[model samples]
Target chain A: MSVREEQSQPAPVEGGSSEEFETERASATPKGGEGCDGCDHRATKPRRKSRLPALNPPLETTQHWFIEAITHPGTIESGMRKAQKIVGRGRVVTDGPILDAVDRMRIYHYAYRARLVECLADDYPTIQYAMGADRFERLASDVIDALPSRKANLNGYGRVVIDYLQRGPGEDGGRVPNRRFYADLARLEWALVEAVHAAPVPALDLPALQAIPIEQWGDVRFTPSASLRILRFDYPVNRFLQHFREDKVPSIPRAKTTATAVYRQGFAVWRMDLDLNMVDLLDALLRGETLGAALAPLEDRLDASHVMAWFMAWVRSGFFATVR
Target chain B: MSARLGFPDLGIGIGLRTPHYRHILDERPKIGWFEILSENYMQTEGRPMMILDQIAERYPIVMHGVSMSIGSTDPLDTEYLRELVRLRDRVGARWVSDHLCWTGVHTHNSHDLLPMPLTEEALAHVADRVRAVQDLLGAPFILENPSTYVEFAGSTMPEWEFLSRLCENTGCGLLLDVNNVYVSSRNHGFHPHVYLDALPMDRVVQFHVAGHTDNGDHCVDTHIGPVIKPVWQLLRYAWKKGANASILLEWDAEIPSFDEVRADALRARRYLS
Candidate 1:
């Protein structure tokens, strides 16, 4: 009566171990001083006279200029110039005994982009792996500049990568191969992260369902788990994610629309492909439809036995939290 | 029995990094305490919170944050402050600490601990914010000296003097990171002793010892490898000067097993003796 009998294998549950998350966070360290997206442009431009800001500007002005300089999307000198143009002057940092002020300022500039890039990489590991480090670093650098982080928590920062990818190619536009595929992959990966962080809710069990009167079963509406994410993608990114997690070389399949169900069960996050019947049924149920109303659309696709089996599988998977 | 403001000297502790959660939970190693990155646990009610709930039940916890941005010109994030207090009560943490530098301004966060301009105006601004934060927490808020690569042209005093004045002005406690002192001294060409000599040591309730990446021209607070020899020496110097505070090792990058990291944190005990 379980879905395992209906599939080649049981739905795969990716272990969201703390070690895995720790490794993701540890990899977010600064990638040294390569500057931002187009750091190579710095070599061609000649160094200008130091335009350090006047001593002791207002704290607000200094913070504004410093934030502008470090996040300027270019070389440290260029960042300083950009900030100076905005502030009507330059020269905020004093030179150290060994390094010049610009060189010293570059540390913050490199770290700002590096931290954000690593955060994006952490959230979208499959994309980072597929794009390779250098290209991914470049894309991440551009995405960071395009979308500045406004929240105190970094967990929500990577949500913008999906929006950025969907906006078409970036500064190095055409170099981003298969934009739609990458966007879909980012969506799946972000969903996985969200599932890992989603709040825990008590799941409804068979006994609880049986506790309802038989006559009232038709009107029993089910509430989906808060961690449950039902995604419809243009590409089979779920299979690709499985392969990636297995440490196998994941190939980008040609565009084919697919539906996926990602949710956390206990400590592990599970990803399963959904057939048309399950997708429609679950979609209806998620919309607060009662059991009878939800199954009505699937009547042509599923028989009584099939419907009962699917309900058993979903209850076993902890997909629904409560029934009313 | 305790350091300043009734906060105990919990002896040697390590940062409660995500990598060591399982080991700490399963084996429940005998460590003095744990310093959690408050931002990591904030705004999430999932597995991390579950794990923290378990860990908090077993050990003494201190909440260390990175996003307070106390030195910024923007109004304090009252929401963040409220969540911080809630988290402290939930975990029963000993004290809450964050860096003295601002992270960003005007609603945009750089996420990097950018250095503060050590001017009189900046000092006054930070002191007022510190008072407000401490008042909100209804406890003595602790601030740590951050590692800086560049000094401000308008700085009226050295970093230690700024910290001393702020502690005097706000009645706040100090975390007094020895490694940050070492890193900043190396980066800005100041004697480490001179930096330590000026600090109000009794105000120091905690010490942070971490490894940094020495890029020759400057040292970045990468918190990577082992605590270097001179950094250990600096800890000894500060401890001798009456900083009876809890000591913690911060290993955020390439962290080893709990045994290795705990061993590294325990290394502080030798200097204390």
Candidate 2:
């Protein structure tokens, strides 16, 4: 099969669920709900706790001025305000005469704001590319305002767009409730990201699994492979991500499928079609169960050779690490 | 980095980023030493750490970090230091270093190298922290001076004097960022040469040259471009001061071709050599 076609379909693995499939629903627990809609978009952040007690700050000069410029990012006396010369993104179009800290800061703040916005554009570019600039401009602005810089580099930024889509970090409609379809797309993108840096896992040893006998097949439980992840979404993010990877514009795809096993084979991480039982089986295994222990709950009647063959196939496919 | 890296002698070299990894493996560029980002290799285990090992076999490596946030008032991130010391021993790093800027406070990391005001009280505070870190690491840690876009109105000494006092009190060497000096000089209206000249030259163990954005009023150290001419001039002046500190060229953003980076290294070598 060709590469695209080969990748288009999820790999078939043994031990898939026999029953009907369902996605894991968000369990309603009132405890510490990620208060998404509580924030008003207009946020006053926590006050600055005492720093290393002002090292070389200008005496009488509240370090707050510079901190405000760096964090809040707009205002002339606050670097961003003075910097008129084309800072990175936010605010208006500019020309020159960005002469000092105030101008530089204004521009820097613009640039800084611009950098934050641009990273999202790059990250969800498929979304931006698909959604058009108009929607993207509005949504991107809100996303930027809601998320704050936490890491040294922009690598980990926008990680919360998925969380925001589910529930807000604070209060108010952080576009989380409104953007349901984004979860799948985010999952798809996140899967690709995981694949990019996923740690290497050793392939399965079929013989070791085959060593178990037919009589004990029903008791054969398995541990989740280190490469394994189960992802379920209501949207066709797999297809959307596939298209996006090829530089195609982000457009919606057809009917939703149930959960799939996202696993790494060699250096590549990919999704394989799976049934409900398989997802639960792997989930059980990941929780640290022995093959006998994990399969004990399945309680499915199985012929000796068939069970043995199934376990053998899973091991050959590089699934399951160690049993509890 | 033409001259050697002090007493233990870290030999001469450059920062081993991915771009130069292949080239260094192939051509094996010459210099005194190299500094790697500490946290980058701090994972429980990975290929990044593996590459560090492979590279360390061929050259000396020092640990430089952005996440240490030493100047932070956040009760000394001991967990981070433990990992740092572990990675240092793992790679056998020559020394551990970070900027004097506070990255974040109260466990919230802003991730920017913030500028600290130069004051006696601030200086003393940082010095105490430096001593604490040194005691933990059991090695002399160098603190680099960060570039500033704004100056505090509080009464204080110049940037150089504060850095000098830091070294005098803490026994920490300076990782003098020449480009930062040049950028901050232009932004705050101070002379880059004077800034370098004011610091006690003997205490400077390393020099950093990188690209900065010339945003009219202030030159911000964005580390995106090739070294500017003025910074090169300042480096030439610094070299004239008679200290042979290892020089590191930082080009983090908009990274260019490996050839272009190597060429930039060659250019830096021209001045220092």
Candidate 3:
């Protein structure tokens, strides 16, 4: 779904707030949380003559101070204004006593910056491309204002971009959908990106052209190729990514349904087309079955010899590592 | 990939980011080496990965990552390791490095380098995990000292002692982040210089220098600007104690012009010389 379409969907549950997030008290303890629960502070005393002494402040005030540091953003202190420009804006420093708005903003910003970029890269790349210098940046700024990241990986920042793109084109919450095929195409682009960094698995090795004996392949359950990805879209999203890289002239995408395949190939990811049967084969393999077993489920009345031949050709492509 | 490259006796280098990419390329400044955040280049194809490859050609690149979350109870993110190995091969990285912290438990990744309690048990857990990581990469690994905001209770020993022993047991080298020392010391109210002096000097194979932010009470290790005065002073102290190793100036957020960043790297080179 496009970011807009996803907006209408309920808030995502993936990696959102967890039930057991660290409470860490309202204060930061010194040395270690001496007498603190769920903390490891068995020995509060320092080692003999170590150059670096343990933290002081008697542990009590230290905890309070640490809490304040994580929670509050001081007023224009420690090159705050200068730091602001370098770190980007909309970082919250004006929140409640426990967690200042700015500190919270920056924490979230740094944490989720990459993920946000992941979600919006395709949708905003045009803006990233056209503005060349900093157009999509504004969207990023607004996106940050609306969505302070809650996750740690900078790559997971855009868990909310789908909704951010859906905000009506009013003012604060208003956003425009721009062109006909842009939104979906942008999402399609993001999928290819998601697949690029998606978990990679050991490629299945086909030793000596299935010399392992087809019978032995039965006990083995095929592992999904780390590069395996399935993308479906209604726009020429592949073309959009190409344009961004090649700097092709911007053109509106035609509204046409499309499903594509993308996978990592020798340290790079490439886009390709997959027939439904191949896609189905991939689906079955992901379910942990052997090639013979996977194809057996297909109702097509093809001869066994024909099916086996087709399977061997695909396996020799070296996409799978070990059948095990 | 090439005879482990062993260890280099060069001076210091800094984290290579986009802001400073041009400067490094243009001048080929006199840095001991450069360390690239491994996750940034883990992708198959992209400008960041491409840029890292280009820079690796000119300098020895160390793959440092924030997402390794080694301290987490998670079953050793095998997928993350494979990608690290892939990137390490591409860059011919000197050694792969990550912090000694848990991002989170279960499957959720917080992205932040959360602090781990300093205990013998935690130490042993991390040590064995490091072995697994080293095995996966087919090279010796380096565990960096994390700049923590809080220390867990019931911790057994001092941070330095724990880190020192960790190297002794794990056979892993240390990529000491100096600015982390400065920021962590202030937040916890300790002496940054003393922290540097306490380290097991011989095991120390690398150093990281970056900028930090201080609130009224504590400091945050925000690699957002130029290295502050105290951190620079501490770097000198670190160099004096240990044999010369590669040091990289990390200017990720307030990335200045190529010349400005090259100037920053040159400034460190001046210290090394």
What are the lDDT figures for the candidates, one per model? 0.82, 0.58, 0.56
- Cα lDDT tens digits, model 2, A1-324, are 112222232454321111111111111010112111211221233223323232333222223434345456334443544332223223321122223223433433444444445556645655665567667655656655566655443444656555555664355334443365666666555554443334566655866655767577555555656556677767666556556656666566655766666665553345565555555556676666655666666646333344345556556556666532
Worst 10 residues of 2 chain B by lDDT: B1-10
Worst 10 residues of 2 chain A by lDDT: A22-31
- Give per-residue lDDT, candidate 2, residue A216: 70
Interface Cα root-mean-square deviation for all models:
3.9, 14.1, 14.5
lDDT of 3 by residue, A20-46 (tens): 111111111111111112112222333
Candidate numbers sorted by TM-score from highest down: 1, 2, 3
Candidate 1 regions off by >4 Å?
Answer: A1-10, A15-54, A168-175, B1-3
Better of 1 and 3 by TM-score: 1
TM-score of each: 0.93, 0.76, 0.55
Poorest stretch of ten by lDDT in candidate 3 chain B: B1-10
Give the range where candidate 1 chain B is weakest over 10 consecutive residues by summed lDDT.
B1-10
Error of 2 at B37 (Å): 2.5
TM-score of 1: 0.93
